[model samples]
Target: MPEGTPELSAKDLRTLIPEYEGLALATTLLNPEPGEPGVRESSLGGPLLWPADEPWPYCAQEDHWTFGSDLRNTTEIVAGTVPTVPILQLFARDVPGLEFPEGKDLLQVVWCALNHEHDPGPVMPLLYWRNEAEVVAGGLLSEIPVAGEGEYDEDHMPEPSTLSPTPTDDYPSRHDLPEDVRDTWEPRFRSPTSGGVMWPSDSNVIATKAGGWPAWIQPADWPDCDGGHRMEHLLTITGDIQLGDCGGVYFFHCRRCPGLPWDWRFDCH
Candidate 1:
């Protein structure tokens, strides 16, 4: 368990509700605090260790725009492409338990810092698994494109922060519990110390974490990969960044297939 975090034992959970047995999953809580981080370090909204030769990703979606109206008529908006900004950079050394593709030790996530109408997430979020040594050997991209002031949505652009990853056991949220378990447990095993709050409410951690079930605000919508295999939750972006209406962005990947296909979803308060 992470220090200073509330204790929630799986054994106690199972004793109260047997159906919860073996439901605990390994997860890493990425506690982010605002700071400047080096390119090689694990961080949120930090500079990426990107290869110099690789073309940077840009969102071509013409519908994206900031919440403010003044900058909406700019030439860049008229051109219809916006540069994607780094949202997260995770190193294997910080999250050793996280599964990585063969020879890959880093995970970098980028998304257009603009809002897309009628979409669940950022205009186009991109994930990359890379070898740290290979990126270093090939030379790093010294110049990265930054979204000009007023061109980016401040809500989606997280301030650069360093990460302190803490590995712990995570359990499903109340929403993810089976109907039978909810029915049987809620009535018979209410916690005396919790006031009126239920056990699951105290147990689940809702923050930027890797692995485990999503901190879903609504019903869970676990997506399947192209190969039909259920994807596993890879990351959750919340608590540290303010998405639309204080929502969370979730990332998932399928390990059963090659290339590790991934997807994302957004949920708000």
Candidate 2:
């Protein structure tokens, strides 16, 4: 490193994350009750058994639902489904002038939001702008924005750090079903109806709940934000990993998923 040697711009960092075709992700909002348990409601002068295991009411909006009772006592359950583009809509509408930059990609934005990195120093640029010119290095790439580069430099090339070939099961795997998956959900705020979770609950804590069955389920081919989603079970995919880097993501699922016994694939994308 030298005094005038330019540093990697935010645009440069953005190039690291290669978005595969399926590199997309969404937030699961509700885990509505599936199959017949004890809830048998047929409503309006009829029975009350949930007419063939329908999803919970407002389950589609589970992302913003306020909790009332426990799963056993309540008649329905819900979570959120945060599709990327729609999720962006939510962020844009809430932000003043939608003036947020350096955090755009859903997973990265969600991670920053979750980790409380409101004042992004390094990651802001990478995730915020896809195009290089719009980045913080906008016009200052070689103008020297920092002075610490020379401080860490050495007279000659330093030897590469080495690790022992001996391996251990220190973090052999990443399997844990996390409950503390925190999220920021507002009250009854309405907008252009972005696709997410909404239900009646005390907190807008965003995370996944038991999907009823241990296997998998998909409610309908074309799911709407309604009763249809609740009936669907938790569709899962698993694998293993060292780190999950997106626009800038840090899914704690590595610790939260193992406990639940997911296949845990090494490569999610």
Model 1: per-residue lDDT, tens digit, 1-269? 22333344556676766668667788899999999999989999999999999988888777676756665553336334567999999999999879888999999999988776667456588999999999999999888888887668788888999999999878888778877877786556544565343546545678898887788877788899999998999999987787867468889999999888999988868
**Candidate 2 global TM-score:** 0.14
How does each model score on lDDT?
A: 0.81, 0.19
* TM-score of every candidate relative to the true structure: 0.87, 0.14
- Candidate 2 lDDT, 120-191, residue by residue in tens: 211111111122223323332232111122111111111111111111111000011122211221222122
Superposed by TM-score, candidate 1 places the C-alpha of residue 1 at a distance from the truth, in angstroms, of 27
Measured by C-alpha RMSD in angstroms, how accurate is candidate 1? 4.8
- Number of the predicted model whose lDDT against the real structure is largest: 1
Cα-based lDDT at residue 229, candidate 1:
94
What's model 1's lDDT at 255?
Answer: 92
